[model samples]
Target: MDDCTDRATKRSFLAGLGSLGFIAFGTAAGRTSAATDSQNTDPQPGKGPFTDSDEPEAFVDDVMAERIGTTTPGATVAIVSGDTPSLTKGYGAADVDADVPVRADETVFRGGSVGKLVTFTAVMQGVEQGVLDLDTDVNSYLGDSTVTVPDTYDDPVTLRHLGTHTAGFESTLDPDIVADPAALDSLEALLTNQQPSRIRPPGELVGYSNYGAGLAGHVIAEAHDTTFEEYVQSEIFEPLGMTRSTFAQPVPDDQPGNLAAPHVRDGESFLVADDVYINMRPAGSLSATATDMAAFMSAHLGGGAVGDTRILDAETAETIHSRHHVRHPAVTNWRYGFHEYGNPDANLLGHSGATVKFTSYLLLALDHDIGIFVAYNGNPSEGPKAVVDEIVAEFDLQQAPTTPTPTWRSGGQERAETVAGEYSLTHLPQSGPLQVVDLLEHLTVEPADNGRLRTTILEGDGRQWVETVRVRGGGRARCPGLRGYRWRGGRAEYE
Candidate 1:
């Protein structure tokens, strides 16, 4: 809590926007490790002290195999201990048509906005070197004088605000696949022409914004007098030896060989989607391998450097993770680009990535010196989330937030009344054919029996997460057995 930025609310809203984690996944529910154990015994090469068993990797191996069975095809995973990747492997085919199997070391998957970690690291480096100021208006470094912001709030959006997703910009891009490179627009052009409206004041509300993050990347690029792609390549990727990664859309000419083709599930199988390009590559559209991401993850795990190649100094790394905003204590909050993910009891930070077809997840148990990453080429009915959850459960969480949950009728009901309403966020499509999704943005919370409240928080996209939530203090409610998520009135909030 070192001068922790803004406080309170849910990190899940960001995840709802396709970014954010903690106490990680909910309980395994009907899925059990005991059942998975009997299904597959694919063992790894090493063991760790996470569990009391002699074969610690056994649980993870079993879990991976079982979970992959539920997916269409192709997932690469990596788990690191300290600066070393203790577990790294692949499952199924990279291209079912080509019959090419996925290789953990070579196949690439879109990192999505998790690439914003690289973007934020670059911005923070700018702050460290006095090239930029975190608290100053971003328009100053934007290099375009005519670009104007909607006069929605008195405060201007700043670098720190973008890092924690409090820039208040509405969604300007759609989840529709940008399959043609010719359709791409420059970052500034995208910002200028399709400029999103600033719906709230800066640094006040926490809404996961791809536009805000992409703008931060643009600011860093302008500060360095370079393109965002060039700046990251020379500063972050090369330093960390993440050679198999690229922000360039249309899969750079020399690297398309390594790119994993996007796939979608039709009933019980994965069908390859056409190659895609994203106009807002800064927000999403990063193609990388799990092995490459592990190197990036290892750099953070080892305090911003790995073997003399330093992307960020120790202090810069810590400052980057410093909390910038929280809407409720019940849900997780942003610490710069990462989230206070996993069990609140355990010191963890991570992000999740999902494109139209591909999905990825990253986790760093900082205190335990562990980093885990999983990326898949296809969207599955079950999703790859269960895999990450099982991995998170391996860590020893020390009874997160030991305070007993205050039961209903004991002053919690009064708090529920004040919070019941229709809350909305800005993650919806602003002006696309998909803008109809804006209807999905509004969440209605009403008091249920026994002092609990109910709402359809996030039920679409293979999720039924928000059904019932227990009222907590501060106009917030915690959905029992769910990850930290609370709602009220804020940027990504309900009224």
Candidate 2:
């Protein structure tokens, strides 16, 4: 209990980093009155009060109203429930300097890593077309390109590994953002020059890599004999009528609608910041509007079709939402191109994204047939994710966190002692200037009374955990919401 409390404290501190500012708006009275009244009158004991079919505009308005103009200059939001857009709205300013108000239908915000969903969608389309295989060596499709995945380990890197971020590529934490759009190289050139060395065996670990994402996009392009942008533009954006979305960096001057200017906090005000270009377009270059995103989300929620325009068949869409990689049983894990949001037990698939100055988050509640997307013009320590978290919590889109029952094993103390130690996340950069992030974020585990273990980070409060044997020779240690344990070289690592 002490450990869970401390970890919550740590999470609070981390979430504060991207906190957004907002301007209050007139409440949409009676918008959700039906749902609110029912929820208040007949509350369920263990479920979210609101239903998936409830009108969410009022709730979303309240969430955004609290943070406009304080952290981000402007923001866009989209919510789709049961194959229809319930709300698509914009608030504050897209360019505070020019005093341009964001229009949910007209203003474009960078989707950041949220765009990876589109890239991965294209990959699935190829799979449906029999042009791509998730388990095949990625090199098989890269024969026309200069890039190649070296035989760094016994198992060759596969599309599945890349999609799951388990390709073992060292984390560079960069998608090659450049100051000048002119400096941006072709997708092929950027991937060839900036490829990171594979540091572990394929599928052995989950190391989030921009390189891996870019590689996946390059593979799709190679397989289809098309540029990454061109492939998605035809298969995804055009089919779904996402006219305001594009992976072209600088967002094509001729593209319709205005681009939302990125912002930075300036005391109590905000200053319009320069927008950078993504060299690896496939990884994080997508710029889109809330309205366009709503359509995209609806397509997924509607089983890969938005009003009869099908980008993927039902089976392909389901496979895309299925779990592809798991780092732990209790916490968030990867699902194809998307990662699990909040509770792993919850049937929610999501991904968070950011450029240097913009941030965005997208989530799909598969069971509920609902999808939420939010993006901000300014990258704060806490941004769109906070809004998504609040929506999920309010709607009961997923199971809330709960205390885990301890396995009353006979020899917990012995196992606890065997696994207690300071360890770093293997997915973090192992070598480079960014390696210090691993050092600062490393975990320190200490045995506690009654065979429970206490774990602390370099700076956060200690968390309590219990041990259970998950495999014949491996150990499983879990906290309230986090769980995973692996033993290698006589060392203990937790995820």
Name the regions of candidate 2 deviating beyond 4 angstroms. 2-54, 468-494
Poorest stretch of ten by lDDT in candidate 1: 22-31
Instruction: Name the candidate that leads on TM-score.
Output: 2
Query: Please, what is the whole-model Cα lDDT of each candidate in the order they appear?
Result: 0.64, 0.74
- Per-residue lDDT for 63-151 in model 1, tens only? 66675534546778777776666666666667766867777778888777677788888898999899999888887886653455565
> How far out, in Å, is residue 2 in model 1?
32
lDDT of 1: 0.64
| Candidate 1 wrongly placed segments (more than 4 Å) | 1-57, 144-151, 173-177, 397-403, 407-415, 429-435, 448-492
TM-score of each: 0.81, 0.88
TM-score of structure candidate 2:
0.88
> For model 2, how does the per-residue alpha-carbon lDDT over 1-495 read when each residue is reduced to its tens digit?
653312352333223322111111111110110001111111222333344434476687778777776656678888776456777788778887787888888999998888888888888988999999999999999986899888988899999998988898887776887898789898888888888998778887676777888999999889988899988998888878889899997788799988988877766677777778888887888999998998999998888887768888999999999988875555567788998766677789887777878888899998877788999887776678889989888887876567545677677777677667766666566678867766677677777888878867776667676644342355544443344445545554444
